[model samples]
Target chain A: MQANRSRFLTIMLTLGLAFFYVPMILLVIYSFNYSKIVPVWGGWSLRWYRELFESAEVWSAVTLSLQIAFVNATFATMLGLLAGLAMVRFGRFRGRTLFGGMIVAPLVMPEVITGLSLLVFFISLNQLTGWPAERGFTTITIAHITFSMAYVAVTIQARLTGMGEDLEEAAADLGARPLKVLTAITIPRLTPALISGWLLAFTLSLDDLVIASFVTGPGSNTLPILIFSRIRTGLRPDINALATIVILVISICVAIAAILMFRQQRAEMRDQKMAEGADE
Target chain B: MTASNSVSATPWSDTDGQKPLVELRGVTKKFGDVTAVDNIDLDIYAGELFCLLGGSGCGKSTLLRMLAGFESLNSGSIKIDGVDMSDVPAYDRPTNMMFQSYALFPHMSVAKNIAFGLQQDRVPKNDIADRVQDILKLVELQDYGKRKPSQLSGGQRQRVALARALVKQPKLLLLDEPLAALDKKLRKHTQFELANIQEKVGVTFVVVTHDQEEAMTLSSRMAVMDAGRLQQIGTPTEVYEFPESRFVADFIGSANIFEGRVTEDGADHVRVQTDVCDVFIDHGQSVKEGGKIWVALRPEKIHITKSDTPVTGENQVSGVVDDIGYLGETSIYKILLPNDQIIDVTAPNQTRPMNRQHLITWEDKVNISWEPSSAMLLTS
Candidate 1:
């Protein structure tokens, strides 16, 4: 009876994993198809990949997306770090509850509503102040930052609170002033959280499509907006090939990160053994 | 009798008439409606190791933080080295604290952690390195300078925290439960090492601890606090032998307390009648003719013997042994008196017991007697 149940459980686990990955696996296989249409798979060839590499529009969109993600992550991390520090360390200022609520409001806000509201806000601001002569890269980058910063701020806030005020107080008790303590102790200790928050912000900006589309103007297409527009027309084989490459890149990055984390754990365990062994 | 003749021949004697290194007047702190520290006045002399000892939630840590400038007084003043420290920030105050958690910076190496305070002052790099090395050697961690905090044991981390604080050489050093994190055996070993380091540095150490044994061993004089107020402050012997209140008597060590009215208050001695018997004191306390008072007696001070001869006195009682607890070095007898009151009497085991049987067993009638000076009169 136990053997039968174990077999049944193993089958179910395999089916679940297949359900998650079969479509992506199929897409990767078809990207090698020498065909014009996506549904019909021709003999295996690298035709679509060559076409994708030759497309200047795709290259420009990649450049624009990378540029926006880079800038947005930097700005969002700065603003979000300040917001997180103020929320945790400012010690119950007036409107603290409201500020805390508003910082995380974008995380729960629907993408359609957020896009529409930002669109209306920008149009009104331009009408009133005659600013933002044209809306494209700058406007879309700003729009991405508005929502991306929420994730960074939440990440930073959790890490900051967990770190506690012990180290900061110890620094001050050791005779360092506030600014000196921040530099000598706090910022160095917060490096891991800051790096992770920046990466989260960067990924959020790169993955955004709706808000970027709403805020963008002519000739300014992020990679997601470009791929989505192409999909609306019809699925092209080049798009499939491009998506396969993206998946490959992301999976490689994840594998590298996991390996690095595993090595870090081993080093920590060795250090602990060293400490314990030193005692004996 | 009050305990006099403290740990003898100390260099930092109270009669030296030197100005106190730290002085607090009416120091009080309130958290909303609960007062953490209330109207406290204390003087800590330089070169003396002082401990503020208490149980949990007794505001001992709060008082230490107030001295470190991490907390502010509600309506009081603090002075350090004859300088008024009312508005001084934690960084500006000439004090450093070793936190209970150790609070070592995990990211920095041991040497960098020690040199951080010196770097903040923009001291020369060579001087900072020399000071860090010297303090590390003092704590006996000179070999682990380049190691991170995680690469060290708990005792080593504690030493790193100590080295970090002591390198700055502040006028006053505050240690909050410095050995509370270590295991039992390590805590005992480190307690003596901490005192020796403090002596070598000659810094005025203000240690806050909940462990009575730690405070007794590490401190020259200790203050016992309860419920945001100081119950008593003196040498360990004074607080243990002649407690000023019932709470101090119970908190410091084991005591059997009895309540009664004073029968007489003579110039040299006093007598009080209680539930089981009357208690006599060698020294008199100020009391009304028939006012209620409490007397505390230590278990070890009472002599218990097999009841062969009848005994009756003001400071003696006769009872039947109810139970016997055989400790390694001593034996405890729970005796039931004729008046249905049970009292504890402990006697040293001068001879070894065979087959787990001692001189006093269950149902044995025993006479317990204590000297008049052994009974502490508590009139509060």
Candidate 2:
């Protein structure tokens, strides 16, 4: 019975993972189909990829998405680092727990609610200040930063809480001023957390679609927004081609990042091993 | 007796003997409702090794932190080299601290860790490299300069921390349980090395530790503290031989204490009528008529014998041997007196097999004796 149960569990997990990836795999396969129809085996060709590259509209949307993601990731990471540092180093005060809860509220709240609220807020600001008269790249970037910073803050905060405070104290004892201590000791020690926060913010910004659509104006549509619009008109080979390209890009970036992190972990373990050997 | 009707004797020349490098005048620190350091007045002589010895939560470390400028004084003043250090921040103070954890930077190499302070002060690049090399050599870590702290053993990491703290050559070095993290064998070896370094550099060193033997072996002068208050401060010989109070006597080493009443008070000594033994104590404390007092005698001061020994110039008592603990160099015997008091006596393990039956047994009749001056009278 135990053997049977183990076999069943393995089968169930494999089925779950396959179920999650089947649609994307189908979409990627159909992007190279020569016939303009569904579920029909046709000779494979690169015509859809060629058409995708030639379309100025598609390239413009891709450029806008990249620009928005870069800006939002930078701003979100900076704000998240400051917030994490404040929560970790400073002692709790009145309403401190409530403030922390509010900062992370965007991560758990419904995305539709967040998008609608941001749309309303931007409209009110434009009415009052006569600035940013319409939602465009600026509004979309702001909305992405507002939502994505929550993930960055939590990831960075966990790392900061675990890192020791002794290094900073030692730096000060060695005659470094407060600013110097932060630059020489604190920042260098926090490099791992900073990189983690940046990646989380970047991925969240790239994945946004509903919020981007709600805040974007004409001629400022991001990749995800353009994809959603295309899907409504009906699935085309161009949209499938775009999806395949995005999947390939994300996979490559994530693979490189994971390899770098694994190498770092191995280096750390090797150093600890050497130290233990020396001790004996 | 209060000698000569004076609180403290004043020296003739301040610089010849030199006033203490750091002085505290009624310094006190409070953390919200709890008082960490009580009002303390102390003088730390230049180039001398001073230790603050106490148990955990006894405020020895807190006092050291205050000296290092990590904690602010709640009241009174602190001076380093005759300069007041109250307003100075930790970064500006000319003092360095070696933390209990030996807080070396994990990411930086050993050389960079030692060079951090110099680089922060904007020293020239060539000078920084030279100083780092010199300090690395001073710590016997010249070959491990490129290795990070995680790539070093505990003892090596401790040396790196020491080199990092000393590279700038601060006026005073504060060590918080510097050798507490090492194993027994390493701690013994490192204590001597640390003392040699302090002497060679000619800098004042203040070490804080709870180990009494460590303090006694390493310090020129030491202070005993309990419950955030300084109990007594003196040379190791004075604190061990003539403790001013029962607390100091018990904390520093093992002592047999007996409650007694004064029967005679002479010009230079006193006689106490103890319940267990009518001992004569020659301490210089004033005791009035019919006043209660206490006497503390070291175990090594008492001699044990199997038979009653007649003595002319010392106090003696006869008892039964209750137990025996044979250490390698010395043997400890517990003798139970007629009054139901167990007295400890330590005898040297000199020669072997002189007397077969005298090799101390349980419930064996024995005699213990000590000189009159060996006992200390504690009034408080």
Best model per lDDT: 1
Return the top candidate by DockQ.
1
Chain B TM-scores, listed for every candidate in order, come to 0.93, 0.91
List runs of model 1 lying over 4 Å from the truth.
B1-16, B308-310, B354-356
lDDT per residue, candidate 1, B82-106, as tens digits? 9999889999889999999999998
Candidate 2 overall lDDT versus native: 0.85
CAPRI-style quality class for the chain A–B interface of candidate 2: medium
Identify the leading candidate in terms of TM-score.
Answer: 1
Off by over 4 Å in 2: A19-48, A90-102, A233-240, A276-280, B1-17, B306-348, B351-358, B361-365
Give Cα-based local distance difference scores for all models: 0.89, 0.85
Pull out the clashing pairs in model 1: none
**Candidate 1: chain B TM-score against the reference chain B:** 0.93
Per-residue accuracy of model 2 over B178-243 as CA lDDT, tens digit each: 999999999999999999998888778999999998999899889999988999998888899979
TM-score for candidate 1, residues paired by index: 0.96
